[model samples]
Target: GIKISDSHDEPELEFFDRVPTVWDDTKVIHGEVGKYITVARRTGSAWFIGTITNDEERKLNIPLDFLTEGQSYLAHIYYDDPNVPTRTKVGIKNIPVTNKSTLEAVLPASGGQAVWLEAQKKFVHPGILHTQADIKRTHKLIDNKTEPAYGSFLLLKEHKCSQPDYRMEGPFRIISRDGEYRHTKSKMEADFSAVYQNALMWTLTGNKAHARKSLEILTAYADSLTMIPETNDAPLLVGLEGLKIIYALEILKYTYPGIKDEDLVPVNRMFTEIFMPVMENFYAARPYTNGNWGSIVTKTYMAAGIYFNNRAMYNKGMDFYLHGHDNGSILHYISGETGQIQESGRDQSHCMLGIGAMATLCEIAWKQGDDLYSALSNRLMKGYEYVAQYNLGYDVLFSVWEDVTGKYCDWKTISDKARGNYMPVFEIAYNHYVRRQGLQMPYTLQVLEKIRPEGFDRDQPAFGSLLFND
Candidate 1:
């Protein structure tokens, strides 16, 4: 008896080389006897057929009835060829085939043949979009005559009307002030926020002027800006500021066709060389602070990954989010037990900031085929409810970490700053949970109703109501 593995020069390898195998679609078409086996598989629009015989050399007629009727295909056959001088003796032939065609297969002892059938058609490149299709759907909704969508579009139009004539000046850099960078950080943030506003205006209104102005700002910064100095707020600067700039660029690229390749080359380099490295290094050096830093840093990394189309960098961002530094992992920050965020003990301002950034990251990931919104079994919603309840002036009992005991031993209480300054973060979450998914978020709904037509404000990653409300 001849062993199938004993054949040193197997011609069957040519089949796999010529035809891509889709394991998911593989089926054993004929294998009643152990002496012979036949298999068929479909990949994309093509099909692969393979047949093998044990010991006995055999002749078999194979039918092509499995193919789609009325369609023509090209069949590439790889058959054993003992007459060939090569060790792996295989002969190839290309023949026209159809559903009505049948072909004879002759096999040597312990030999096999492979056939690849492909349809004749034009090829097209499947380019990746910067944002998800859902985002595109939302953009269409903006034009619909509805409550939130209409109001959101009008708010963006108002923002466009408020902008001045475009100006470009940079190679901009600022160092930490008195061991802090809050003032300089705010300045950088506002600049990028303007870019997002302009890009968004172009997207909604189809106004060429808005597109041109946005490109002007982006080109200026991408050309002149070399580095952002590492300051006390470097993490926030790189993550938060970089995220907003990425949003602006994504919108600009999506809306405008006239942006030159030269303009974007420098901008891409800036992200890869400067902003990305800063974010990665910061997260590596200081992992998990049980606060907003991890989320902010991850948000930047994810944005950079999407902008550059780098899967490794994108996965790195997801890793940081799923398993962050001690006390800082998104899972740990939002208590599984009580559904409250870790930073609620510190203040409402920071807590909201963290929640806002996390939601933005989730939105981005959701667009890219990741369900991060439900990663921790809806822990994000719990965190939102935990904050929204207090911000809406409702008292809820919960536990928080006490610095003295180093454990969650104190009763939760609203801070003096609680609900005082509303951040434009509610729209994104509200749209996803309440509007899109139809999940009830009463407190969150109340917050959204109060802040309808959300506009850009300092420190908010997304344009909020303007971009996400619908």
Candidate 2:
């Protein structure tokens, strides 16, 4: 049973003999973008109580008729109380509810209320029963070591602001600095997505201090992007990467349970109002070379669709990848001249970005209720596997490279030194690690874990002997 009330709100679904049999058993209350949503789901039925606030305080009167009225109702209310150890700790109260019953809840200066309702059997009042089941279940799903760590990794740690000297010399830097971008464009714009991904991780780890700091960084960067040039030489590249950061802000809130409303406000604004329009223009103009760069365009738009909950955009993005685009796969590079479909071709960063696009699209497909998208993602994984099983040598290096001259090439012979640094092991270990079905060390994970002593495990043959030298 679920009952939530807000002032000037009407119950959408009429309560009847129907009992909420499917409860999510998980309750997450946090600000999503500029709003706070308190959700309590049991089995399959979910009671989503949400409030949107800006920089000011407001009052909301939530109603109780959303729950079955004929039966006894018990509401466990958790508001942002000023005087409490855990600010959101709940209080239970027994109440008889009818179709017209309503409850008044006071919201904070910039916060609001969230409630969980448990309905009891008509014969035996549910108000009297207090069980630790829901908390336990929430803990079970959320407290897992990997889930929190994964969120932390994706949200916060992955984008550590160290800004190594090596990264400054990359193509991305060239695009940012010398690509004829407007003076308003900055490197922070490129780093935004990475920043919020870190913030989400920080929120999940219960590292409140670090989480808050991450949010501050994210907010500041987002705020700085308020001004950007409308036209640029590399608009497609910059716009897509910029949109990625904006989109990350949306996914981060859902990935972590404790994200505050204040942290999400600025991020939400940029994504909903600012970035959406830019993306629409990009898609409409077919900005990236006759849309042959579908891989990058599709991935960027897919993130846009999922983050904004725009099913049409999501479907169109997926369609672009699957059928609309010239190439079967969604990823292709834009040539500076003649808008031909070019590829870096099995290079380290190129392959990883390719796989990353597939991984992201698969996640979106899962969310959009399309099983075929799921299958395409699998096919992509298989495509990566084709490189691993037959086309791999020692050190997880590629067996063959598809050079532009139509001649087979070797990984060691790649011209770009920075990309060449990781090519050998990348095509091999990275794929295996992502799938978690084989024993190989991912170069990126290993690189991030570099400063630690256990960074290189000598015991594992694949990691120790083939790749790293002790």
Candidate 3:
């Protein structure tokens, strides 16, 4: 007979779900030839034990000596029960345990016991952009009528009603050289903006209508669109355009229970079959083509990996983010000495785009326990400061290389349009550096204040005030 039950209701299965990886301190505590075996492993201050027996039944003594010295834990034990009159026959009990405690497990013939020992304390939720706790905290803040959070919530409520309507179906294709292609691309961008804004609004407001609308838009495209047509600017389309939708899906899937598992299947398949391959190849093959390409694409890859819960994909994206192939990595674009970005020679628009993308990436990474913001002795902050100084109309002394030769040449001057359209890029950086880290970001703060109540617009970088200000 096989043990059959909902995986969600099983202790061992739940333990595996929570602790995806086991610790290196795993060891075989006791074993007997053809009789029984017992093994224990630790993960994130918790210990899990599994014991198995042959046809012969045996009683085993389990010790809690491996626990942290000063901490206590609640040990959840699951074992086979012959009297339960079910094939699964699993029964569970909770026992308080300490480093000095010992437990006895009674194993039946062809049966085993599983123990999950967890510390009774607050634990941090894991993720890149938003954690479970962060979502709960956002809810609490809104409920408490907090200032910026409530303001952002009210703004999203108004924005959802007044936002432009988007089509359900799309012949979504990329033909960068054609005017029609750009129009379609812009339309798709507008659609994603609606999707993400609505999904996030649903999270804040608990309105089922908003979630349903977001799902309606998502399912329409996922069911109809097979692939995004390739073009000269495939990387940009996949990275910038496709990634925004991915972000919406991430928020929806995690925040709302109304989203069915079946709904996600097709969407995940679309990502794996179409977007994943393109992103993998783009980052590996075209890392040096343009600085913005790597920044945007790496952000997409990292966020997609987190959405799908794929560690390999996440690590691959992180690797490309830190170390690019030729001249496309963050380190490659950011100057270690002056901290000016590589695209600064081109224009401030692309410079802000690149900086904003990298800043968002660092924000997500910081949430996931990686400090790419301060990597390379605060290289990203330096890049932000350099760009902010110039964009704020401050004169900056820097040299630009026109070609591979070390020849210094004057490129396009920073235009009024570039300086005026400051994307909501400073909120995340200012919040992290100034409010959280207690570090000074004078220029970043000035720009952030200038763009107070930084609302959304039809642009590559949207949802800044909604995400970061709160």
Candidate 4:
């Protein structure tokens, strides 16, 4: 028999309804195309979930209150994306999983996953709070009794570019030789920034070996500067320059803390000679007439330039994002001599990029005790409220202006768009800002808290508004 249960004559499960908590089993184990999965979900009265795969390993933070109030319950998980059906889709097997549960989940190569929760009678507290300050903090935070958004962004920990030939791999695959032609060539057009971003996460976590490997590929790209083409149509597949280069330089400085000023001169030379001119032309020519294209690239470069204290380049780059267009102006890529301004994901994403970059710059400035930088930072933070309106769903905010209708919708309706889509990152970031002033309560609660018409928790409200100001 190909597969069977271990029994004397018939198939039977060895551990029926036995909840297994494996917090130690953290790393991903399997990698299969469209069908690999592994997760370590927390099991306690309050649920915690962690999911990852061979392709990408991401962290998740879930609050304990996503469960039934004052009741100990169990979770029945069915974790596989049904849309991606294959012969090896994990079969559904009902098991006794509970809130005080930290379950391990493993996913395959190219496939995705899903996790479900159902109430079962089982109560166990996970000793989450202890000290007086901790208790006070918790009480103050939840006095309004709102739930937190349980989402994660694939943040980079650290990346080092010492050796000159390390390249990273991509997640997608082609079925045949001809099919490969239509797809982006992973090697030829690899996105170095994304690789750096992912590597940064490793570095932040003190994974020195992983950080070195990621940086190796980046150094290789910098060494072969002449070979890498100047202009590439592939948006995701371009070499880092200007502000990105400055970011890389900052990393190098961090890695080699005791290096002399003369040693830094050579690294600075590469930016001034090779990258600076390109930035000047790119900013001056301004090829992208409409859309967020120019702003996104410009802001990335400007952020880096600002870090190096390149006043002229930094100002121009900042201007492109802050004042190039009026608020709510959209970028339109139409058939014309100039790019038209139409609401698009390109602009929305760039808008976030602009605001986020400014925030980081302002923080750096404030730390250095520079009043000018502090002023600029404050201005950017105030301006960000206008763009924060665009965060749409869980991990997938609406990039197109049309999706939001250029005005606030009802909170329930906003919750509808935020349901189960891959937009959790934006929600978390936007909430952080809004929550500071105690205004994140209603909007966040609208999504995490289920609405009931007649005391039935099962009846969730659909199409609710997320526009509660306070």
Which prediction has the highest lDDT against the true structure? 3
Best by TM-score: 3
Report clash pairs, candidate 3: none
**Per-residue lDDT of model 4, residues 1-470, tens digit only:** 54643222110121222234544223343334643444434344323233445555433333333345555433333444343222333333333333344444434444333343434321111110112232234334334433331011111111122222334443222211123243434342333443343343332334455445544544554444442224442221221223334544455445433335565565465556555555555555534433334544454455454446544444454334432332321211111111111332344544443343343333223223222221322233333433433342323233222221333222221123222322122332233345433433343343233331111000010111111111
lDDT of 3 by residue, 1-470 (tens): 34444322322344445464648678788898788888988777778889999998789898778788888676777788654322345665566678899999898888898888877542223354667676677788778867655665666667643243535435353323224456566566566667777766776677777778777776766776665555657777777756666777887776778888898887778777777777777755633365777777778888777777654566566656654443446656777777777777777887788888888778767776766776666777888888888888887766663321223235644344566568767777777777678888888777776776566655444445546643
List model 1 lDDT by residue over 1-470, tens digit each: 66757553233443544565344477776764879888888887688888999999988888888888887776777788876433666766567779899977898999988888877432111111234443565567775656666676666566532253544333254423224434554445555666766766666666777777766766667776666667666677777777767776776665478776676777777777777777767766734244687788787777777766665566667656654433455656787656677777667888889989888888778666666676555778878887888888887665655321145345366464656466878878877777777888898877877777676566664446546654
Clashes of 3: 0
- Clash totals for all candidate models: 3, 26, 0, 63
Query: 1 or 4, which is superior by lDDT?
Result: 1
Error of 3 at 457 (Å): 4.2
Off by over 4 Å in 4: 1-185, 188-195, 227-245, 255-270, 325-341, 345-432, 435-470
Candidates 2 and 3 compared by lDDT, better number: 3
Model 3 misplacement above 4 A: 1-128, 140-151, 160-180, 286-288, 402-417, 457-461
Candidate 4's error at 35, in angstroms? 80
Model 4 poorest ten-residue lDDT run: 456-465
- Lowest lDDT block of 10, candidate 3: 401-410
lDDT of each: 0.67, 0.40, 0.68, 0.34
Off by over 4 Å in 2: 1-159, 162-186, 189-194, 230-248, 255-265, 286-293, 326-328, 331-348, 367-369, 372-378, 386-470
TM-score of 4: 0.39
